[model samples]
Target chain A: MNAPAAQSVSPAPQQGGRPSPPALRFDNVTLGYDRHPAVHHLHLDIAPGSLTAIVGPNGAGKSTLLKAAAGLIRPLDGVIQRGVPARRIAYLPQAAALDNSFPLTVYDLVAMGLWERCGLFGRIGQRHAPRIAEALRAVGLTGLERRPIGALSGGQLQRALFARLLLQDAALILLDEPFNALDAATVADLTALIHRWRDEGRTVLAALHDLELVRASFPQTLLLARELIACGPTDVVLTDANLARARRMSEAPDPHAAPCVRAA
Target chain B: MHAIYAWLIGPFVEFDFLRRALVGALALSLSGAPVGVFLMLRRMSLTGDAMAHAILPGAAIGYLLYGLSLPAMTFGGLAAGFVVALLAGAVARLTQLREDASMAAFYLLSLALGVTIVSLRGSNVDLLHVLFGSVLALDDATLILLGAVAVITLFSLAALWRPLVVECVDPGFLRSVSRAGAPTHLIFLVLLVLNLVAGFHALGTLLAVGVIVLPAVSARFWARQVTGMAGVAIIVAALSGWLGLALSYHHGLPAGPAIILVAGGIYVLSLLLGRVGGLVWRALPGRHLEA
Candidate 1:
């Protein structure tokens, strides 16, 4: 399958040189469900147009952080300042987050990427068709437009989701475990798309499990173990000492920990 | 040829009550069936059934307040349904119980309370009428109410269609992108309660949900998209109403149960023969597609 160039899809308009602010700033943010803090004492600043990998052990709150950035959850304490509007943000949660059993065609699902532009009642005119078709073509899903999403293979579904993301033309993209259970080829194709988005100057944050892929592709990395372990160049953050500390901190979670109260 | 006419068309043509009943059933089918399809898609079919029962107390209160007044009972039923829905949701959020469990508890109480309230003032005949419904007794006022409900339900469904679909498919995504998710959900609940209130007038509280749910579930076998499923559901529901009413005319059977039973039969047939994922289609191993 060919990896069609995404330039024909909505290209991000060129912005001339200007002092860039942090794409996101997490100020002492604490996020969890039901007062149980999955992420605590986190302070980080993400530069504009940076492709960062958030790596952590199981239960280390990678998904939680992305969700907070997407404004899906409120911070239990402190603040997270997102530089983009909700419409300018595109979030691709885990595959399990979507109801794959829903009866939707690939074309229709991809068309949803036009939501920010068309809105609830806006018509999808003749002009919009080519954009949707180009998105599908970019992700190698051109011929499968009519197929029901339930009939799609895992790889094809992920590709279709990527097509939707491509159409989003978002300034900031948050991906939560996007490549789990996918073939190597699918991963490669998707990674290429991510690179294209980065080239077009979009801030991309991905919660990833694959250290090798992160090392090769992601320039910056944030290692988390319920708290900020390290954030720097991928090589520096993924060091032996930092990895061991992350694993140790994430291993034991107190079931009966007292209600957290931290003074600034 | 005349026998066909006598069997199928004669009863509807001859009796004014039969014609009214047919129109009432068709209205329910048009509006209620699509709502059922959404309920089924959301896996809230039983919840819809529970909600149908939850309106009993409200209608009963109306019946108690004004003797068989349509407007009173309709308002009471609507208020009651909304109260129960909100109560169940609150209970689920505040306490350890899930929404379904709380809904179940509320509906049972509502049903019993409604029945007691009705028997407090009315006779066994009236109790039967409230429980089993009186399709043959539908008046012009009731007919107009049914038509209006159909129009409102369809228009609301169309207006909220996109957000509703996004909410169903990926709620977290919807929440992230737009605020339409929660408001759209609230409006959908209103539609559900409204349809149930309208349905109860024709089919009674106990059996109103049957017309709503049966056609929606059956539609799953035939269509693989929301629009297709709703279309199939409307057709199946309308057909069931016609056949069920015809059966009542010829066999001296009760009308509500007869209609539901015909819908049940269609559900079974769709289960066997439907093209998308029906039993027979699944059972037969078809040729694999070329990649």
Candidate 2:
């Protein structure tokens, strides 16, 4: 399939005529478990206020990259620098990662987003009440505040999680498969919120599988297969050739192996 | 009214041992029950059981060394409990064995070592008292120790409340937000060891977990929220203590086992009749649909 033309190719220039620093920069970073690199030698920059989609086939290090950005895991070989402090970033793992059996109310779970401000000892001040209410209303979950999170349907749980993201109000947001298993209505609502965040000058990087959705909404894309295949404006980065290259690159065996590498 | 007074009030008013037993049991229930509630919530009930067993070798060593010295036994139990927990946690992290399996292995070894040590130094009577406890024989020193543990546990639990809840619900989220996660977990383990050591003085290691776990599990059937569950568990624990002391006074039953048996009875009853999610509620027509 032909890739769509880029709609917002260039970021708006600053008043001083200097390009803004990237919100996140990965310098030759390699991340893995048990010494098997899932993402290797990745040099990339996520520009401030940009909404970027990361897409590739299964096991393409999409989630690993997001975890590194969130500072949940350390890189084995290189560095990741964030313009904002780690607390100023919000990360939402795949819904499956959460234990729904936990007996927490929707209100309590969403209130966790305020932990950066309230901390372990501080009370949720009255000033935060309006914001929490607004976030819940924004996600269409105002009426479900008192209900247990386990009682929520999958779509409702996704909405509740989005409500939490709204509360986080982070400068940089990393979402891993946020729209997986979501119905069309929930996806549309969440997509509009993402657009609003971009309009508000917040940076968002989402790992997505739906190329059609990526082409429609994301102005930039990073195509990966365990390493960077392409990174640029969406239309230029997501060409048929790039995807085929990623697939072939992912399927091929490692040629840099020492003879004893397998044993190690 | 007379029968009630005779069965409950008369024992405590008439006998000094009964009053002391009641006080010690209440102190244990206050702190131990809440810990149990969290243990059950984290699905670490078996770990709590294992930790209790692990305390035995240390207490036995103390018994062997100091000849029933309360301070020595308490210190030894705390040290041994902490060591086993740390070793099990380390082994689980570094090896292919799951945490539960490692904890089980360590605790079993501790139990065997403890029984051997006790048998080496004392008679069968001494072993029986150590295994089942002498709730009626609590001295002023033991009472003071139990009270101190309760106070410290309550304060520490209050300070660690928010972080502990976050850790139990989603440890990864806790780690992502702040550096308090590991310390919060460590503090919780310390509290567990302290409460278990305190419990050993009254109910013995074998039966102390009953006071901690039974009431908490029973409360699970009745309360939907964490605080609510803890509150219910505390009440259940206190009630078992009082009723168990009464039965021991009037009927000449063993005090520790009586308390545990009372708590077990409540657990069974709550499983059938509790308001939150009892078997009876599930059995009722249309109740499942409503729930």
Residue A256 lDDT in candidate 2: 72
TM-score of 1: 0.94
Q: Write the per-residue lDDT of candidate 1 for residues A1-264, one digit (tens) a residue.
A: 121111111122237866466778887788998788899877777877888899999899999999899888899998898788778999998774678799989998898888899888788778899999999999999899999888899999999999989999999999999999999999999999999999999999999999999999998899988888888788988999999989898455578989765653
TM-score of each: 0.94, 0.94
- CA shift at A76, candidate 2, in angstroms? 2.0
Candidate 2 residues B1-291, lDDT tens each? Answer: 999998889979998988999999999999999999988888888888899999999999999999899998999999999999999989999999998999999999999999999999999988887788889999999999999999999898888878888787777777778999878777888888898888888988898889989999999999888889889999999999999989877788889999999999999999999998899988883634544
For the candidates in turn, chain A alone yields TM-scores of 0.91, 0.89
- Indicate the docking level reached by candidate 2: medium
Evaluate fnat for each of the predicted models and list the values in order: 0.66, 0.46
Candidate 2 clashing pairs, residues 3+ apart or interchain: none
